[model samples]
Target chain A: MQGDPEVAVLRLGHRPGRDERITTHVGLTARALGADRVILAGDGANRAETVADITERFGGPFAVDTVESWRSILREWEGEIVHLTMYGLEVQNVEAEIREAHRERREPLLVVVGAEKIPFDVYEAADWNVGVTNQPHSEIASLAVFLDRLFEGRELDREFEDAEKVVVPQAVGKRVVEADDE
Target chain B: MQGDPEVAVLRLGHRPGRDERITTHVGLTARALGADRVILAGDGANRAETVADITERFGGPFAVDTVESWRSILREWEGEIVHLTMYGLEVQNVEAEIREAHRERREPLLVVVGAEKIPFDVYEAADWNVGVTNQPHSEIASLAVFLDRLFEGRELDREFEDAEKVVVPQAVGKRVVEADDE
Candidate 1:
């Protein structure tokens, strides 16, 4: 996990009462974009169960968990923490530097995505506060762009292990194959 | 518009009965990520109005329109078309080639994003049918990645001509400034 800088996503401020779909997408996007795990923070309803369902249905070498203290998590992480925010350094400007550092150190990477009013401490704690664009946009989009750049687009070919369902690429129609389908 | 690829996004297969937020994001993402215009295709209720409202509130050098025939639009487009689908070629693999061709030909880029079951014709008609990743994922995410790569992340610095409200990047708190604000 360390050699290639295995990536883990930390989704902060999940408010299920407001928009569950967005929170769910935070985790789903992480998994789809080649993150090895998703850590859901905040008191979002059924956050763990929801991610569990996704892993169960999609099949995964992925993990999901809920945490109460994102600050502690950030402070304790063994590798660099890349915080996705609009106020930070533009991603393109610093991505290669971060990637090189991670590879050389052979440390895992933790990506932080915020859902609510992010505390300033989080910003200060991040080794690299990266912005996909210096504009307020969806966190999902920022994570997608960041991961794409981080991996140099090789994540597109990532294969999920033990997938209960998988999409087969097609030129015309949509076809999803299940594990039971011989 | 031609030399640098004036980009237009066509959001296909919108249904009023379905999710509207996702459709709205298609337009918002396009504008935020650097598309010059977003063409909403299909009978989704208030699709055009939604995007227009976004432009009005968010500020814009961006435009929004609705069309009945995506095929007709595609057939008559003045430049090359790039259709986003999981079934398409990996974006990273083809993006450089497409950019080189578009620049050499001075052709604009029309990016097609689907909201429902896309017809086979789109796959065949596209100059480059591209995938951010060959996985069933959100359309908004795909559009972001595509635009980011197309512009080589320079889109991150694009400034809107007349933004009514804009977020001032902050290290801590959220602060949005209005055009008339002191």
Candidate 2:
């Protein structure tokens, strides 16, 4: 899990019962796509538990936590802030510059993904306002593509440690085995 | 609005109220990430309506429909079938071959994305079972990354015909104007 710049995802605006699954997906996507941790900034405690459970079951150095105030994290963050939004600059256009600021500069990266209708200040707070595509789609998808671009697809080869279950990739079948078997 | 191969996404096994937003994301992701259409196979009529509404407002050649049988669509599809699954072959390893089949060989591509548990028959049905990353994340994320890789990122520049609202990419603010304004 040694990447140049430590990456964290902040999941903003979790509407308790309604966004549980989407919030969980955001956290899991953060873990799977090479982010070191995710801070769930609202009432996403249960979603944190779900992500934590997945990490425990499927090996992780990844962390998930619930925070009361997202603004404090943004205000105190030491490195770059990237907000993924449909209204932001296209990812392809800005990815290389952001990647250099992140990796070459060795600055820790905090990626912010919001639920519907993000506050205006979040955009102002961001060092890079990025869009995977200007067309409306899932925030999970945006985050996934953004991370893939940020890491330049090397994140896909990442192997997690201390996993109970590990997926053995198949061509035409499903296979999940003990990590020892891997 | 022309690409090498016509791509359609099939969302499999959606539960009514629980999967409403996720299914909507699946359809929207398909549309935004350069797919021609999305076919929701289960109880996703309302999700189709939402996607259609977005298309009407944002402009699209994208189509969304609710289908009675996912199996029939798979059987009836005359092109290459790729199922996005965590248990499938890694996308990075197989994308070139699949791309050649779809683009160079002139085969239409059917990308299948499933909810929680897809049946074994689906594994058998797909010509290529592709995984964006062999880790549990959102199917919407998997579909997005898969399409991004399939099209090699050209889809980000796509323009929709006759759109009322188009996002004007910004550095730190939101601005969506009429497509005519462009």
Candidate 3:
């Protein structure tokens, strides 16, 4: 998987717990996305304290690192579909980098997994924007199915393009409404 | 309004960019709560750039400040009832401070806002707890009505003591089934 790459799952967070959630969730997403590789990009780690937890959950050919190191990895991999998931409250620069990476490597679709509203600048940067459209309590699986479709040559049509894209300052409840409406 | 201590409104934030929605929705509530002070907390001024977007729609008297400055103002004000509305997303120490303040100051009630899950530890720290008992997108006014009756001695039988709380992650379009059910 390392000699040539196909997917980079970017989970942006400086915090450890969130990084862990993103790493675990992303690794799970990789198998379904059917990319050549799955990488966890965040500030998380696998320590002795979390080893039991990790083995039980995040099964990985995993490379976990900060966004900078992942950037280095993506450059090395050259052309792969990168799935970007933003964690935590601050996402100003991370989205820019995703858009920039998309511009540089147009081979892969940039599927953004957003926790909250993406900033306005990020939205303008996007080629296509859509909500995950996963039903409530079914996020993990919803994303999994989406990734699977990507592997099967999914174009991310209106179902996805119409997804309620939440940018900054929108209430979480409102996002729930938009997601349901679409 | 701050000088009068009877201004009947308060606007507080855990951080910036987070106060506007809560403040905007809490106006009818203040009247219903018979509140004379609206205390906005946190570094909301520096962190929240969208405050103006929501505040323009606001029609209430509220004081907002960074956490550093709000303390002095809080010490000077006294109320028969104190409704503490705060954002609870990764809080670890809310219980001790809120309880100590309540015990030392004889303030009867503290209303915690912005959490789908009520912090039991924090509630244990205060005299009583209040929360929304409706579906998602329920008006902040409804909650205010409940609190008003709760504080003005009109609805002493109304209770937040045994309220069932729902906890949900902030990811939008993610399954948020449990946040509204009580």
Which candidate has the highest DockQ of all? 2
Error of 1 at A16 (Å): 3.5
In model 1, how large is the Cα lDDT of residue A22? 62
* Highest-lDDT candidate: 2
**What is each predicted model's overall lDDT from 0 to 1?**
0.77, 0.89, 0.33
**DockQ metric for all predictions:** 0.38, 0.86, 0.03
Candidate numbers sorted by DockQ from highest down: 2, 1, 3
Q: Cα miss at B147, model 1 (Å)?
A: 1.2
Q: A57-126, model 3: which lDDT tens digit per residue?
A: 3233333333434444434443433332222111222334444444454455434343333334344334
Model 3 lDDT tens row, B79-155? 43233322211111233344344345545333434323333343333232322211111224323433322332232
**Alpha carbon deviation, residue A65, candidate 3 (Å):** 4.1
TM-score of each: 0.82, 0.98, 0.28
TM-score of 2: 0.98
Instruction: Name the regions of candidate 2 deviating beyond 4 angstroms.
Output: none
In the range B100-131, model 2's lDDT, one tens digit per residue, is 99888999999999988899999999999988
For model 3, the docking class works out as incorrect
Error of 2 at A140 (Å): 0.4
For candidate 2, write residues A125-171 as lDDT tens digits. Answer: 99999988888888999999999899989999998888899998999
